[model samples]
Target: MSPSQPEVVAARPLTGPRESQDQEGAIPPATTRPEQRAQARDIVRLFQCRLCSFPLRDPVTLPCGRSICKQCLPESHLRLHISYPAVPERLQGFQCPFADCGREHAVGDCGLDVVLSKTTELVKDNLARGKAEAARIKMSTRIAVRDEWEIAGIPSLRSPSPTSEILTGGRLVAAWSMAENGQLDFDAEVVYHGMDGESDDGNFAEFEQEALHQVQEVARTEMDCQICYALFFDPLTTPCGHTFCRSCLHRILDHSLYCPICRRKLAMNPLLNRIACPANERLDLIIETFWKEELHARQGILEAEEIGRHESLDVPLFVCTLSFPMVPTFLHIFEPRYRLMIRRAVEGNRMFGMVLPKRAHFSSDREFHELGTLLRIVNVQYYPDGRSLIETMGVSRFRVVEHGMLDGYTIGKTDRIDDISLEEEEALEAREVTPATSPQSEFTTSEHGSPDLATQTQAPLALENQEDIARIPTKQLLEYALDFVARMRANSVPWLTQRMLELYGECPDDPTIFPWWLASMLPVRELEKYKLLETSSVRERLKICCRWIMEWEQSRW
Candidate 1:
């Protein structure tokens, strides 16, 4: 390739660097192809496999700067971790499993064939812009310094009348039980000076002071939630040193009974009276710390609102599941968090990013993705049952790098991603490939001569010979299956609608239990699903589906 001519680059018109910042994770839409991989460096920013010298096939890149074919990765590790049954995400780091590569490294994961095609001119344009940015940063600067702080003693309590002066203090004894039932029972008592107080405010105030005041001594004990948010009443400490409430565990497990924190097997047996609650000393410290933290959070916001007297209280945080290309691609794989996410997205334009957790150890700490789609809640329907169905459409896609976890939701720093095309339909002419007259004959030419794909055929389908079927691309095959599934399942039977959709994109006209047939051939492990989830472009999905279908057929006969 010829080097970029500096004069030509310099002369080009400029759009500001801010305009060019990446707004989405690197993944091309379904339109990209391999032939472009060699020449489309300007358009594609995705990671390529280090071993095969391949550019973004099933693109799996890790933060450590290596790439691998997501297809080749194990289903457990091969697919995007988001749909891998625990926490969900589109791309995740994969280890280089290259034969005898002999290196312990990870590549930041991304989708292959997911980016838009750009020309050499675009690359040169971006490079020139980048050079200008670097020059600007170097030309301008700022000084940095460490922040200072001051620690202070607690303020005196505002008690009414000093009353109960029982035993001044004793060790605060506390015991907690994790019983056979879900309740986390706790018994806390403080051994303090003689205590006698009336129920009236005067006495209640004094007693409250003595009960809550600066406990003469309390150890600072804090437990980090393995998932997001502050600890609740019933936190379960895991063997892997992670702590999450039973609800959080249930949330992550999706009822599979696995630990959400570490993706490890959980103990089915219940814990009985697991440990002693923080002693009186520890309890006081925790309460005080919590109070301080809560106050700190509300301080600035409340002060402003109090002065303005016109702030709305709808402090909703973005909480949804799928993000970006991943969202539309995996619409059928119904996992709980994401199901809730999509439902919530449909509630309005305000949607949040679903950031992949930086560390599984602290996934539950209000952790969330930054810059997400403004999921407009387009439809909401409810019946006699308590649950409601929500439908949403993406307003804008965003990339959130420094994501911040919010209580009860996910929020992140986002840059909006522009869509080249929305849910626009590409019309296909009425070729009329129906079961009755659509070319459903065997090929005189040995099956497998479609230009884009070549499947090894052990048994040729009579329909394979049909002239029209012989010319279609892999993408068209999916569209056909999708259309067929929708037509097939137009009626009853919702038992495994999601499963069927995952297989063929929709319920078919015949309502046949075809997923079982499909699953019988493709790899049925969790990891296989992960690979399917990791796929970005429609073409990649088609390729994987084609390979798996062939594998399935080969496995049988």
Candidate 2:
């Protein structure tokens, strides 16, 4: 029948005994038997179709763990085909009927639930037998009361009429007299003999216990993660109407962006972090309700794994170019392995390490430099074909202690590297201070009336400049680096473009960060610039920058 035209099973009134009791002017004892029956009927309602409110005909289980009759399943459509032509052409299904569980499902993904079907049949049979037995006992009670009234010489009151009603009222006094003398007590007890059947109660109780056990078993089987072969922990449902543990799905996506069971393409956003992909709330509730202890155990295991991951310092590594702390790095991720790595990083802590590739002649043992910058993902834009452009900012410098390859990408255990504390910097500067000298005095004047950078190193003034730089204050060092950037921009240096300024921002006011910023913008070789990562002293990095600027100016001359 159509869902709107539900076939309701209305409760049948207690006809025989109730009618007889009313005619005999007898007051019946208040019993909870009817209320008990109503409760049992309500429990049976669980087997009814959610759509039609009738006993399930062919139960089908949705990915969200709700069961509905197959006939009640919604119509499938070709919407997925139109939206994503790359996806294989097939009829996609509809959302679950339950309001709390609206996870979309494909027609092919939902199938008949054999266990629920058998359990439904058992419930129907038990309900039918109970109703029939109650009816039989009720009918027998009415017949026995009529026979006892006839034996007591009371006029037959089977038919309701004016005469019968009057005679029944008159016979009520005689009936009570016979009842007090115990003439009607034996028949009354015999009429309710069937109600005390121990065998029937025992059989029904057994059936109920068995049905409950079957339902629990079905729940356990359904809640298990196919990949892990255990109760689902943090379950997530895909658009294809398949549910899997969140971790299992993550591992699956690393290999292929398709549903493992249906082989259907999963629509996923690489930029969407793990928090955005929420677990199946309804399915999680069901799993918890059925397997609370198992779920807790699974959670403990996951927590332990998380703690171990942190203790090991394991992190994904992106080995491509040199990156410095506080600098922004833009990457075009197209390779499959790197794509997977980016997804995992975004989903996880949104952090990964970026290091420059080691030259083939430099090191055959390792492919990348040990010193690298830890990058935190800032933003990500994805293409329809799985390509993505990600923006990340370097958080800190790290040294790879140990490294390995995973799914074609690099992974490493790293320790963070920080510049010396302010106190340490002050002490070093104080110990290394020398007499001050003007920077202009370091260069010799050429015929063009400008400083000749090439001859500056050979002049006596060059040693004075070096001595003054060693004792220079942090503020003065920053000023020198800023002045060098200004000169380069004024000279219209090829690498120092407006875009570069906008990208890295004008040289920072902090002396320690200034060196890394200038070093990143400079056209110096990566290996030469790699020195910045090795040094802990800010003054030392500034010295390296000064040497680079001098070499560039000398080269121009």
Candidate 3:
């Protein structure tokens, strides 16, 4: 890995360091033991309570630069909708008394552990809620087995159709992402549930209520922008129902209609700052309770298994990943469990599996990507507030053979892949590979080798066809792969951008040139990345990668 690589950079590249200097605590030192030690010490400082003389024992650092114990930051423990770190004799709750800044950090030495618990809880709560709702839909409320109340092919029944239906998400609470206005919004997602082709809107007021309640908690600290990694005070949400710090998200929206996370169409109002919306409060309450219960049950299973017998451990349940070159999980505050994940990856094997969410139930439907990288954990550091800074290097690419939702997380059967050739590797080593980066070169790379495929309009092209495109060699199918990236846009390209440059030396601002310290970023989808993870033969893997890139690019572009 290149020690010179930027820790977090956007596609357009980040113009500045985001977050309080407290976050700078996550940067790890150079590989040397002494430097790493110094960096670790510096990182540890970020976890200390800046306001108090003590270290943030059970660190829950608020956006207001205060840290508190998790017990002190209970969800409904607030006396008023405000945050005050110093618990006063008159104060009944841990809520920060500050007006707009109401939430103080939840304190606890599980400090890092607590944050991980929070994230895992986020997933768990969602999955459990989904299951409960499924049970509701499964139950025949009126002597009919109907997850859907609307009758198909008949106009008689007034039916409420769901706007979206995921087979199994832990809790499946109403997915009210932070929108342009308010904290969340609601929509009627409908899906066909029974053989009768009947569908119904699954919008529940209770679910919306759950969202609002959580927002009250989430609002206390505010969120760091997903893009710039800054505290999201007065955050702006997109039409796609995704939120980001206003300035960070707008930069992308201004250029094109794409979600910064998945590059999908954000059908949202650009002007919305905070949307006041409704949720099914009653259902949300019931479902939220069930979700917590289920997570505890699952955690119990893991604990009991550890004490009794070792089950088939190789079967990877959750496919966590840190991709090379891109920081998709940017500004994501490090939680404890994830911190544990980083520790294991660093100490045990420096390896972790890259898995994809099922195509149907992912955060976005466009997320069941065709390719992805089995990124190796490269860097890990703890911020003073106990959040972690982590880096993973891309080692292999993967393809999804099949995908489905298991328990509540997305699951898939995957195979590993490689797409670079001996010659291309030599070229990359020589730093001789070039990009048709200009609009003219971009078009030329696409049309030069094709006899009848000319006059096709193009998108803003990044990266290059590392191969000599004038000829499509029979043995080197990877050439077809390079051609694939030439025409990709939105979310259709397969994984392996940095690798393409590494083997062929055709990357932008080429980092892996000649004697440089490291390779550039390798971009791929979760499945493609998973495939690379599963593959053993490097040569055959390249062929598989080439085929996937071509297929994905061909489909979208």
Model 2 stretches astray by more than 4 angstroms = 1-307, 310-313, 360-364, 435-468
Global CA lDDT of candidate 1, please? 0.31
Best candidate per TM-score, number? 2
TM-scores for the candidates: 0.25, 0.41, 0.23
**Model 2 misses residue 309 by how many Å?**
3.5
Per-residue lDDT tens digits for candidate 3, residues 59-119, read 3433232344344454433222111111221123234533655533222111232332243
User: TM-score ranking from best to worst?
Assistant: 2, 1, 3
Clashes of 1: 54
Q: What is the lDDT of residue 469 in candidate 1?
A: 46
Q: RMSD, model 1, all Cα superposed?
A: 29.9
Top lDDT hit = 2
What is the lDDT for 489 in model 1? 54
Compared with the true structure, model 2 gives a TM-score of 0.41
Candidate 1's TM-score: 0.25
Estimate the lDDT of model 3: 0.34
The worst-scoring run of ten residues by lDDT in candidate 1 lies at: 1-10
RMSD of each: 29.9, 25.1, 29.9
